[model samples]
Target: MKLNILSGLIAAALLVSGAARAATQLITEEEAKLPPPKGAVATDRRGILRGPKVEFVSPGDSVSSPMRLQLKFESFGGAKIDPESVKVIFLRTPNVDLTPRVKPFVQADGINMQDAELPPGDYTMRVDIKDSDGRPGTAIFTLKVAPK
Candidate 1:
């Protein structure tokens, strides 16, 4: 009887450890299946909790020198967003090398904004936003930068 109880305790401990690891694993955009056509904002709901709803705020399709861009994320389905977890990447841009750029400034209310003095050209950027619980959302937009 003692041996059986010891075996059962070991099994329970292993199960609990596995559950903890699963809960801390971060979910990626592809795994979450959150792509919503180009230039469209989308929310990911594949995780245990729903992600934020992303929206574009500034810098229309056409822009000029001293480009300023803004992306706003709101909690969807009562999810809490982690503003510091926001990230923006320059997917493609003419006459520019894709290097490590400065991180965008995140607001207290889940708004990430960046300002850059770019040359005359076109650019495409991707934004990734996530919640405090590891749920992620993504957005892609293009900018036609013209000479000011």
Candidate 2:
């Protein structure tokens, strides 16, 4: 029994360490390349607007409650878009244009959230992508964050 218990503990450790995990093809900002899905878009008084293709997948790309509304962006022409020039907004109020945001990461990809953390109710996610000159570009999407 002691040996069996020790063996189970060791297996759990390996799984959590990600050592036993196989290589995963990270969805690059480019491969995140899927045409933006539906969601909300808007601009704040500061004049920041979200891209048209902004979207979400899963928080951490896994199954869980209170799942995160991820954001996806793409620029096929004119000016190329990157993550830094983007922003996310989550709110409880409606019809009011506000700056939705998080700490913009230099190396962050699409947004995500587990299912449990987000409370059930009406919610909205907004995304904005900026041009090279630091002006808002043309892109937008909107979606309702509700019960799973």
The most accurate candidate by TM-score is 1
Shift of residue 92 alpha carbon in model 2, Å: 3.8
Best by lDDT: 1
For model 1, how does the per-residue alpha-carbon lDDT over 48-135 read when each residue is reduced to its tens digit? Answer: 3456667878787777656565667777666677766766665521212222343435663544334455556655566677776677
Clashes of each: 0, 23
| TM-score, per-candidate, Cα-based | 0.55, 0.41
**Local distance difference test, candidate 1:** 0.57
lDDT of each: 0.57, 0.42
**Which stretches of candidate 1 lie above 4 Å from their native place?**
1-49, 93-104, 108-114
Off by over 4 Å in 2: 1-64, 93-116, 137-148
Instruction: Give me the displacement of residue 112 in model 2, in angstroms.
Output: 5.3
